[model samples]
Target chain A: MTDELDRDLLLEFAKAEQPLKSKEFTTNVMRETQILGNRKKRSLWLYGLVLLALCILFAGPLVKLGTMFAIGFISPLVSFENPWLATLTMPVNNIASIVVAMLIGGRFIWKKASQ
Target chain B: MNNYQETSEAGIINLARTGDPRAFEELVHRRQSIIRNLMRRLCNDVTLAEDLAQQVFLKVWQSIAQLSRVNAFDGWLKRIAINTWLQYLRKNDAMRNSLEFNDTVYVPPPGSNGSVAMDLDKALLVLPEQVRTCVVLAYHEGMSHPEISEAIELPLGTVKSHINRGAKKVTEMLAAYKQPTAGEKV
Candidate 1:
């Protein structure tokens, strides 16, 4: 019976609470939401720019990777071998070779003019 | 109620699910006090309660898009509130003080001071956190043991034990306040 009374007392006390009044409560929460939303958008844009920059910076290695995979489909035996020596012997064998040669030629010409 | 105020919570939640800030603001305006009060009861500190309440709403905003049951927002919000408190406990002290309940030591919480909120805070802060949460949700929020279990992700048996012992401890602590004053009762 005592336990019952105590439980009832607690319930009544809690239920009788008037709502906490604060003029700025909702405003503060909304301000935070807006701030977080803007941060999320900003970070998304930053991530996109970073990803694009990374792709550009490593375009040469990426193209070579794509070429190696493409060769696996065209001639299935390339996947089975480790033939790094073939690239030295046959430097202009594919599209990957042409891009690398063009890049190297452009850099040499640019550096020579700057000198 | 004005026509705008009469907008059903379901309608507001549906609009919020589409990432509309106005609808979300309507949600905050409507439920902030209830959430804040619940946090205050759970945490026993006014500032922490308000901050946690804001965090709960922010989480709701972030993930409400994925909330499949629009009508179950109350339970969803309660779940988030419970999670926020539990996470705070995890980071701050890992709830290591849970085992330190001194049953024999009694510190009288003075008179009721005409503020049951203050007394409730004192009464609750006496118990360890797990017990305090169960007792608060069970008695204060009127949630069932199973509901408390699901919200706190504890087993049903553990929830029942906490509420049982926690309620007993809280009642024992507050018995002084419950006593009638001189000339108040025969």
Candidate 2:
């Protein structure tokens, strides 16, 4: 029967010797793992240091400077009552309209060129 | 000269999870032979198989912490090995894409003098990669079709067909070596 044939053949295959083990296999694997582990540890330390630096920066004069810039940037958009706010909003709006116009023109030209 | 031999696999896995190189090394030493054998059969290139086996162990070392079941270590290791082999095949798409049939000849042992198992091993190398992998897993590894499907990430139908086809080929190749019965002469 076909089953018998398959069984016999498979049995023969199963008798094969296991692939010969390399003498240095374990040593090489260990060495690589150690190197990988060290790299991971160093990366973690670097991340920690960057986080600490960011915390220190945010706690210092950087926070005040950032807050001042944010308020100045947002004040014109939220309300343009002061002359300085009008000045800031005018240039920003003009630049924004110019960029939007350029984008639309570029898209039309690109579509024509592509076609 | 290492004390690693005294430790259990679970103990070693714990150490490896904690990034202990010696413990991982011990784990490698214990399991490398089976993994290498499986790789050798799957790839049919001893050097490539060895390299892939090393990669499998490296993966195990790197991702041991992600394994949810400690007792499923063998299955986990096999899954990693199979995935690594599949990835290699995927990257070298040309190997699978080629229409060329493997033409390696299977020379049967002369007059039953040599080991049939040795001949079978050589014959196995001649099979197409997918078929050989299915046959080896089903027979040598004692895996069922469904298990092989999941492990190899092949469809169940394809796995079944590959096993059937592979078994038939092996049987045909080894038919000459089949022993004669009482009425038949060798």
Candidate 3:
């Protein structure tokens, strides 16, 4: 009863026709998608290049700096007669470097957050 | 994709995803009338419905690849069309709010048959947005309860409740209109 009435009304509503879009709409959508796709590709390439440059600039230098600092500072303590002390202090030096790096990273993030 | 090649509708979607403008055009041609009708019923405005229908197709073109199941294209497209209109309505909330606030009276235009159709439309307009959407999708679009729930992202129980409430309201309005007023002579 109610279902039949609802169904009839729905059919009547569905039978109503809407105006068609202009022919240009299809071409316009394709063009817009193409433009967006191109922009995405270019931006991805740019990000890849920037990442490569950052790795080149930072990776080798950071590793070298870490190695040099570890050897320069820890080698002296390790060269001493007390090898156990040197071993213990070697871990301390590594921990200290890691702590310093984390502090600097944290401060940078904090600054950005505050802004 | 070729699995659905025998089905022209699925084939059209596959081609459209692969950037075949003609295939996409065919898909649009086939479904435009239905989409337009759905839009008109959902929005209650013919011109806006047409514009939204075009926007729906444009979105379909742009996001075709993201659609994996070709068979469910109609449901997917309908969801897009519904969301597009919902977004438009949300953007124009101020206008709707003002209209509602100023127009408290629900005066029926002359020559209304006091029939089920006019009563239902009037009753639907007064429903909450979510409920109205469910009713429209269920009744107007011929979607099953599950389909309506999925399209509108509502729970099945909620969808059923909406339909029930919407139907009750329409029935009540119709019944009220049928009864004679105190001042009116038989």
* Best candidate, DockQ: 2
Residue-level lDDT tens digits of model 2 in B1-186? 267889877888778777677777778888988888888777777779878998998899879888777788888898898788888877877336532235455655445655654556566766777778778888776788888888777898988887887777777766654544456565
Task: State the fraction of real interface contacts model 3 keeps.
Answer: 0.27
Candidate 3, B40-133: lDDT as tens digits = 5666565676678778887888888899898888878878887787777678762144212112334444344564444555655665566666
| lDDT per residue (tens digit) for residues A1-115 in model 1 | 1123244656655664658764478788889999999999999999999999999999899999988877843442223244675544454555566666799999999999999
Candidate 3 falls in which docking quality class?
incorrect
User: What lDDT score is found at residue B26 in candidate 1?
Assistant: 81
What lDDT score goes with residue B19 in model 3?
Answer: 78
- lDDT (0-100) at residue B116 of candidate 2? 54
- Listed in order, the DockQ scores are 0.19, 0.29, 0.17
Give the poorly placed runs of model 3, Cα more than 4 Å off. Answer: A1-5, A17-28, A59-115, B1-8, B45-55, B83-107, B111-127, B150-158, B165-186
lDDT of 3: 0.66
Better of 2 and 3 by lDDT: 2
Task: Score residue A104 of candidate 3 by CA lDDT.
Answer: 95
Residue lDDT tens for model 3, A8-33: 44554444333456455445545655
Error of 2 at B8 (Å): 2.5
Cα error, residue B23 of model 3, in Å, equals: 3.2
DockQ of 2: 0.29
- Candidate 3 chain A: worst 10 consecutive residues by lDDT? A1-10
